[model samples]
Target chain A: MLKVRLIPVMTFNGVSLVKTKQFTNARTVGNPIQVARVYNSRNVDELVFVDIKATEQGRKINLPLVKKVIDECFMPVTIGGGIRTFEDINDLLGIGADKVLIKSKALQNPEFIVKAVEYFGSQCISIAVDVIVKDREYLIHQKNDEKVLMKTFIEKMHQCNVGEFVVNSVVCDGMMNGFDKILYQNVSQITTKPIVAVGGAGVPSHFTELVQTNYNGALAASSIYHFTQYTPQEVKKNIE
Target chain B: MIVVIDYGMGNLASVQKVIKSLKKEVKITCDKKEIQKASLIVLPGVGSFEQGMKNLNDLGLVDLLYQEVIQNKKPFLGICLGMQLIMEKGSEPNECNGLGWIKGRVVPIVNSRLPVPHLGWNNTYKHKEENQGDTLLNNFYFIHSFHVLPEEAVECTYVDYEFRMVASIEKENIFATQFHPEKSQNAGLLLLKNYIESYA
Candidate 1:
């Protein structure tokens, strides 16, 4: 049987690795290279490095740091955060990134997804949809407070030939409670794309629940792996 | 020294990093002389089959590659799109001729509940009869929409993504894996190490 992937997500602010609370109150975590080295020894299925400050700071992801992470880790690396143009994706892939994640860029220009898919194949492209439930409705959040319907955004990306998705919940993001199951199921139903459920993964059972719910993979950040309980191998054992 | 052929396609740095981690002298180049001097050749690629073939042809490496692997019997390994290029022809990104080293046809993976690219980790099961009790069972990362179907190559291992698909193959001096061994953690590294040590 194919194993359910347990991915450890590491967020970066420029060059330093940091953890966020609902996408704010960013706290320094550790060196991204050192953190990735730990995950490398844990036999992790994959690693996601999101540069949280890229788009907001009006600069591209730190390619030098990306190279450092790629050099230290052997498992497949999926880079997210602040990817704007095709050249950025191409440059990253060239330097050993297995996949590139697009968020604000995709929402800003839907055609970017089409062009990216055409240029780099859908397998290498992933979109991270950050969702927040506000006043009895789901809204996609980015740079602005502008509210974009989750279903509509997903539908547009699906049509653009997106291969995988990371449906993250802004409300549940630094809480470590558990994933927003209802939102994930809804997004999964909308498209057949492999969805990586992120945010609010606080325990080992949370991983099992994700596998039971048929989520293609589960991503956790500050919850179980911040030098807490359940290493990646332990979580994989629990999921199995 | 292991020479990783670079033809303007795919991630060659990761391959070089892994090989270096293994404490082996490795080089990434397109120079024909370097390829000739290396003890083994690794063709690692990811992209359209047509484009990959065109790059090799453009670099004028097809004949040198054939001479190294066939004439010299130097161990050769092709990974992902590189593996597909070993076949006689590929159907994706329009039909194009391949290296014709292996007897196979490259075609799109049969549609299933899974997406077309077949991304993520998958269990690799070695053939029971062909098994030599080597460690090939650990999970390996896979991300390809097309697969190679060889006519006469030995199917060392296989995976069932709704259908029985070829995972790895072994011939006289050639070895190829559909999965990205460079990206497949410890098991993948072990496979590469085995190739480097055993296939001479």
Candidate 2:
């Protein structure tokens, strides 16, 4: 059986990128190239580059920025930032984006999902779910930063043919309050596709303990780098 | 040199950069002679199957592609829509007919828990003989919605799902990855390079 691996997501908004959260504000961390090199040395399985600025700027995947990412990183790189069209998707994927994440695009024009899969293949596409806890239930968050009921989004994606999903807990996002296993558990029971749980990073055991089912994997940021709590290498060893 | 078949609407440059990352010789070309001359050929595209098929027909490269892969037996690869094109026909509303190199139908990953145009990177199992992980499977990227049900299911190596559909197929001199090896980093580039170097 192929075991679930770790995918460290690095966020970049506007021109500057950040590794850690400074209250509600995100702070600049280091150069993407340098951080990627650190992960590379650790034999990290995959690195995700999400340009937070793209959707708002009405831009596409930053190929030149991607070129900068290509400079120092040598692992399987997944670029997801303001991707809204087949042409944009093609450009990024063509340039060496191992995987492209579709969030708002899928919600807006579900056909865009079909268009992507028809052209790229399902595995090449990933659906990212920004999660939030409300009224004792997990929910789906969108690019407009709105949280919708989970059932609707899941249904929408299922109808369209999404390959995998990343359930990111907005509540647990930066607090390191431990992963919301409940959220993953809820989603996994319903979906057969691979689920990557993002949002919180309380600790390593939190990952092993919180994620009850064998199918889902937890994704964290601050806990791994700035907090100096766990490195991707260490997490990989523990998971194995 | 690996020749990237330019259908004018496919993912060409990305594949080119990926090949370059592995320090391999590659070119994106629409010229038939250049395609014929290359030791390896790649058909990479991103669009509806109907549009892709139409592009091939309009460009008049379909016959040449079939001739190159079938008669000449050069190692040929099709990614995403490229892979679906290998099938007999795509059942989507697109009214597309694939190259028919393999006996199969390209259909929606029906009742897909995931959305259509199944996009993103998922793991792949290898074909029975190819399960040992060749230049292709080390690490690969994937994006697609429709999957081929090869008449020769036994020819399929790895399987993933919008619903238990094939993700990759290997039959003799012809090999195709349903995922994007180029976008898959070292694994993607390595697979492309390995395919290029592996003529036997």
Candidate 3:
């Protein structure tokens, strides 16, 4: 098995890097270069720079912003948010983004996921799934931001041959309360690939506890970047 | 001095920047004289197989690159489309023939489910390699839609997404990477450093 990675989430607002809660209440945290430098120095596994507003704005992956992050980061980086075209993915990879994340688009056009894998090779493909409880079922977020059944999408995505999945519970994210293990366990039971849990990660032990059972890694925004009680290394140490 | 073959297709500045990071002397030149005299030459391209070759021909460097990299055996490296150019032919175009230095062809990354233009840091599954990390294409950064599917992979880096294309190739004095080692963080930087210390 490949090494389980610990990816710290760096969500962007326009060109500036900011910290937000459940996709709201944006707060200026620091520069992307400075934050990336911290992640680099701390010996984190890799970093993910997500543009929370890109989808809402109907754009592709922010190339210049990705370049800015790559210019400073020493570790591997995975980026998402508004990546909608092959050209965008190509340009992003060309410029320097190590990996590109797709959630809504994969749901919209599963063939894009397949073509993405074929063109770049499957190793570069990353599938992201945002899950939430709707009428007592785990539903997925469609491209139009609508809700659909999760199991069907997960099954299809696995068929798409995505290397990894970043599964975050929409209701649980940014709350720093905890992770929705139900969502993780559900996906883990279905797919053999690595799964990284995102959303509501508040403490160092949270990551450790999650990886113990099934999930490969736990991603946190508030605990690592905000509370400052533990470094990514320390958090990883606690988890391992 | 190492010459970064100026084909005007790829991220030249980044490649140049990476070479500089290794504290090595580099020149971005299409001049065959300058390139031929250099100790090493780099061929980098970002566009499709056809346009890339067209650009090289239009710039009058296709033959120049062939003479230097293929014939001279003066340590040559290709990145992405540049790497594909070493193969005999690609799906690029009819007139868009590669240097034919290596025996192979560029095939689309084939799969029914995955998307086109694979983009990301896919872990390399080395295809039985003599070198784990070298001048280029180790466990490095990769971003592309098409790759050089060599007849026999000389060296490969393994990754999880799929059996990745040959990460790096070493034949005689020629070396190339389907993935961009320059953009591959420390692993990539180390490759450049190796090029400076050992090959060049």
Candidate 4:
């Protein structure tokens, strides 16, 4: 049987690994390649690298950085952050990225998801839905004037034949309390797509609890090395 | 030299890197002449079956590869979509014909209630008769929605997941895996090493 995967997500700013608070106040942690090598040795299920500023800065994904990471690391790596067009995804996949995450652009043009799925099997594309609560309701109102309901966006993407989804909690992001269980459960209820619960993972039991709810994977950034002594191995053992 | 077929389908870099790490000479190219002179061939892919077949056909490699792998009996290995392309036909992206090297049809994995793609690492123990004290064909990284149902089930060496899906197939002079050995850490590297170092 395929076990539930425990993924360690490293946010990058150019070549340096950085930590952010609700997607702001970036602080350099270390070299991404170096950090990836460490995770590789740990035998984690997979890895995710998000170029936090790529979309906002209006640039493409860091290809060299992705190449360097996949060179040393021997697991499936998903690259995200500045994926805006089909060419960006093509270039990333050409360099050996196992999966590419699309966020802002998908929201602007939902049709891109359909096209991407048509070209590169649905398994290769993951949609990252950044969500925050507004007026006591969870909504996908990012920095732009455009907005869509979280529930509606998920249904639309699923209909578009999206392979998986990364339901990011903008309100709980970097807060380190725990995951937005409500959000994850709600999304999981709507679609059977692989839900990688990101943002606000503070401890091992947090992941343990998420797995009990049938969440496909748990993605941790700060909790792995910053706030806890638990390694991915330890977390897996805990759940077992 | 071992030639890794570059049909403009999947990432051939990691495949080349893994083979090189095993202290073996390897080359990545689409030229039919280079493929003709190679001692061994590795076909790696991770995209649509239709496109994968079209790329080989466009490069004029289908007939040449048939002569080399089937007629010449050169050791050939396919990975992921490459493995799927070995089947008689595939039902992905469209109903497309394959290289027909193996008697099988590639279809989506529907028996397992788990996610469609069946991503992540899983253990693949060899069948009882082929177990033969070799552990190289154990755990590997798999990422695909469709799997091959070969006419000769004995060709399959490993199966896992909820439905005992086909994981790795091996016949005389030909070996292919549904999982990516290059990305499968030590177990995968050892499998590649065994393929290159242990001649048949």
Candidate 5:
């Protein structure tokens, strides 16, 4: 049987590793290289690094920093944020990134996703969908403060033939409470493709809740890893 | 020296980095001379079967690989698409010919409730207990939509993903795995170390 993946998401502010609450109030946590080494030693299933401000800054993620981080990782690493073109993807993959996550560019131009999938294969391309809950309904949250219906956005990207969807809950990000189960359930209903639930994982029970929903993977940022005593292996044991 | 054949497929750095960490002299190149000098050849790739074959052909590596791996019997290791390419044929995107080193056909993983591209970590079991030292029965990272079905019985490791699928194959000097041992953390590193030491 395929084991459910436990992925640790490391969000960067271009220079340093940081944590965000509801996608705002960026707080510096630790050095990314050191953090990646820790994850490598812990033997986490996979690692994700995202440059949260790269797209808005109109530049690509810090390549040198990512290269150093990847050096410390033996596990598969996914690189994202400010990924706008074929060159960006090529550079990251060349530096040993196993997969590249596309968010803003995927929405701004769905054709880019199609072309990327066609050229790079779906296994290497993952689409990140950030969602915010409004009136008990999931809405797609854009960097520019504009919110679109989550269903419409998901349906549009579904046609692009990307490998998997990294569905993140902005409202539950860095909350240390629990994951948005309904949000994941809704997205799973929309598409049968693999869904990796991100944001709002705080405890072992939270992951157990996620597993009950039959999702493929769980991506946590501030779960027991940063804010508590439980190790990633411990959390994975609970899920099993 | 281990030459990681880089046919412009996908990331070869991870494979190179792992070999370097294992303290083995490794090079990533498409040069015929480098491959000929290599004590072992590692072919690592990620993409469609059609594109993979095209790149190998375009780079003019198909003939060199055949001479080095098949004719000369150089120790060879293939990962992911590298493993798939050893089959007689594949049907990813469309029907295509593979290297035909192994009697098999690569086809989409179907008839399962699980999602396609059987992604993430899964435990592998040895097809026969006697062939234990070569293949480890541990969890390894896997990410692919198509798997190779050997036409004849081969000494292989299998993983259960609602069905038994070939995880790795050990045929004489040729060793190939559908899982990314480089991306599988400690278990992966150990597997690579074992492979190199066995060949060494």
Candidate 6:
């Protein structure tokens, strides 16, 4: 009786919360803590907070901002962006983060994912696979403007035994159209790990459509709670 | 005071925050003296069974917890890894011995065609018909790969994920759950409140 999860993905720019389109053209949305409080009231399944600018700024996600957000909500929070070492993971978890999302670091040094799983256990460590579709193929998108075959990256990380995979589409980000079925179909062929599909969800049916296909969860940013009139609870009702 | 035992495994802060919000006196400590002074003890953890036992042993908390929970009969609650550690043995990363507080063995969930780490919310049903109205029977968040199989009949609640899996257990002064009540929101908060009111 495992229920599919509809999680809200919050993109932060170190200080303020922002929403991105295609992983660029960041637009400041609202205060991080206030957004968290609203989600808390709605009782969303889980919350994913990524400091989009942390990697470019060469620092970890703003801890004070994260701590304040954690205080405002009493649910699972996944912290990501600019995580380079084990200390960063420990610091985030110490401040009440349920799981640490590793993106750039996991690609740079895959060994870190193995070590992280060995030390913190698979339940606490999740990897975010940001991808872009090119020529009808998925490519692993990196901040340094390098792209690798998505299949190769996913197969390699699957061997590390991480808890879950967050398959996010950089091209479809903030588009509010719908999810990329081909992207999910491609990743599903590689591994059976729990997947949280991210990017390009415009409506509640968009979530239902993805969940009915393959993903165990759907993560949204600009749809439902952000840009539309539907609340998370209302979306959950639609899914149910 | 309710003492949340900290063995450096999982999110102790969220557990502390939830208990604090309930307006109950709570403390997160591994100190022996503080534990002895506590009116109730809560062990909340998230990790593998082997590592959890290792950390508890290295911190010299194994014996202390045994004395307080088993011998002294102090009201005790174990969450996730905490609940699994009460079993006599577990086969997660490898075969390892547990605290043996309960006569059971922890093993990978059976008949679950779903993912390994069965992560998400699921509805739980009370084992006893009379306990159908139990607040803990509501949907709760769970994130784990293993479940316990008690050797003896104990009051329990179960969730069906291809098979009936133990979700929560209750014995005289011991109460434990495989799901995280802290992260479960309203249903979770109500469960904690019920536990505190019944024991503390």
Docking quality band of candidate 4, CAPRI definitions:
medium
Q: Model 3's A-chain: what TM-score? A: 0.91
lDDT of 5 by residue, B149-184 (tens): 998768888887888899998787789999999999
Say which candidate scores most in lDDT: 5
* Reference-based lDDT, residue A44, model 6: 80
- Per-model DockQ against the true two-chain complex: 0.73, 0.19, 0.12, 0.66, 0.89, 0.87
- Pairs in clash, predicted candidate 4: none
Best model per DockQ: 5
lDDT assessment of candidate 1: 0.84
Which portions of model 5 miss their true places by more than 4 Å?
A: B128-137
Write the residue-wise lDDT of candidate 6 on B1-200 in tens digits: 99999888888999999889889899999999999999999999988888899989999999999999999999999999999999999997899999999999999875536677778888888753324465334879998889999998789988778777899998888999999999998889888888887776
Off by over 4 Å in 3: A58-63, A85-87, A104-125, A141-145, A158-164, A189-195, A214-222, A236-240, B1-16, B23-39, B43-66, B78-172, B175-184, B197-200
Ten contiguous residues minimizing lDDT sum, candidate 3 chain A: A216-225
Summarize candidate 3's per-residue lDDT along A121-207 as a digit string, tens digits.
555568878777878999885446566788888889889878778887778777777777777878877876556678877777667
What are the clash counts of all predictions, listed in order?
A: 0, 36, 33, 0, 0, 0
The window of 10 residues in a row where model 6 chain B has the poorest summed lDDT is: B128-137
* lDDT string, candidate 6, A81-122, tens digits: 899999999999999998899988888899999999888888
Model 6 has a DockQ score of 0.87
* Lowest summed lDDT window (length 10), candidate 2 chain B: B127-136
- Give the Cα lDDT of each candidate: 0.84, 0.70, 0.71, 0.82, 0.86, 0.86
Residues B1-200, candidate 1, lDDT per residue (tens digit)? Answer: 89999898778989898888888899999999999999889998888899999999999999999999988989899888888898999987799899998887999987757666777787777754333344334578888889888887465678768877888877888888888899898889988888887643
The positional error of residue A97 in candidate 3, measured at the CA in angstroms, is: 2.5
Q: In angstroms, give how far residue B110 of model 3 lies from its true place.
A: 14
**Tens-digit per-residue lDDT, A152-210, candidate 4:** 99999999988888778877777788788788888978888877888887778877777
Per-residue CA lDDT of model 2 for B1-200, tens digit only, reads 78888886544666776667666788888899899898888888766778778889998999999898999888888787788888888965665678898887887766524444444445666444325545335545555556778886546656554336676788777778787776565566566667665651
**Ranking of all candidate structures by their DockQ, best first:** 5, 6, 1, 4, 2, 3
lDDT of 6: 0.86
B-chain TM-score of model 2? 0.85
lDDT of 5 by residue, A73-115 (tens): 9988999999999999999999999889999888788899999
